[model samples]
Target: MISAPMLDHIVYAVPDLERGVNDIERQVRVRPVSGGTHAGGLTHNALLSLGAGSYLEIIAPVPGSEAPTGALPFGLETLTEPRLVTWAVAVDDIERRIEAARLAGYDPGERMAGGRDLPDGSRLTWQLAVRAEPAGDGIVPFLIHWLSEPHPSGTAPEGCQFVALRAEHPKPESVLRVLRALAVELDVNEGAAPRLIATLETPSGRVELS
Candidate 1:
């Protein structure tokens, strides 16, 4: 059976990287760690350490850039602004987990190689399955593997804490089931509206459901 290991990161799609980063910093009170650029000109990434082997990420397409060199691996092109788009869950063995997911009746998609630039001008490479499309109504989460590197959270900025997570519609219990079935450790609360919310405690202040 496919088992999710741990919560990886939450993603937010924005129109501008700088603007998004700035806004997130102001709200969270801590600047996110730069994650470099993607294949296309869609440069992005802000890493917020969420403690306990987890973190939050804000992603967006860089303006005036080409549509991405090859194909739009993940259905990232279809995402709207400020929406909770994609997320990752850690796995001990990616290949084994992929096979398990296939057995669980998920397409599992194709494996792709991608790189992210660090703040110090260094680059990191990793591989993961590209979802054919964004998880509609926030039902699904994008699966990922970190290749051969440790999760960035272990070394991300200090004083960042993952305060809380909220999900809308579709029921957080249902979502929690999928995550649990995947072997991920998530504490979800039901009986509330459908909205995936995450609160972050940063060095500067607190960021709630943003």
Candidate 2:
């Protein structure tokens, strides 16, 4: 089980934004709040609180938006259904963390700034580190440093508690090695494919989302 203190937020990607929100609400019994649109108009998102400091991000294509200028983040364009695509970990000095990971044989790419407009006319800004290739196919977490105050979790819809996180990968050892380099720990099991499994305590009772 991964520690909650080190966990930031988990990403749930879908092909249709509103449909995904409804499906997740039906399962968890908690409606998500609008988190607002991203830069490029390629995607938009809604947020659900996963207890203090952490949340679940439901991301998808912005309806009627222009064609993507390039490949979308997290492969949202081709997802067949809603899936636990990846996750992020809050960190300080993200650039330093990226350098440290590279020294340990894993490169988390470079620090990049990102922001989205909030519903209240304010903007939420942050910097993140992501690899050109998905880090361990999205099992290993990326790094994020929030530049804004009073994190999104504080204002998101509540009632879900993040319980545990783990993964299944055909090559567990390789994934573990990268996690070690980043100083993060996770329960991983050998399996046929790479998948992230998150256990949560929702109003609907205990549930697993992957």
Steric collisions counted per model = 12, 0
- Where is model 2 more than 4 Å wrong at Cα? 66-68
lDDT of each: 0.62, 0.89
Model 2 Cα lDDT, one tens digit per residue, 1-210: 786898899999999988999999999999998999885667899999998699999999886665545567788666778889889999989988998898998888889999998878888899999876786789999999999977988999999999999999999999999999988899989999999999999999998999
Best by lDDT: 2
Off by over 4 Å in 1: 1-5, 68-80, 119-121, 136-138, 170-181, 185-194, 203-206
In model 2, the Cα lDDT at residue 26 comes to 93
Listed per candidate, the RMSD to the true structure in angstroms reads 4.1, 1.1
Pairs of residues clashing in candidate 2: none
**Model 1, C-alpha of 89: deviation from truth (Å):** 0.4
Tens digit of per-residue lDDT, candidate 1, span 1-210: 112234677777676667777887787777777776766546567776778878777776655655735333233555456665556766556777767767665555577776787767766777776466533344456567786565777766657777665555536665655554454444555544445566767776776653
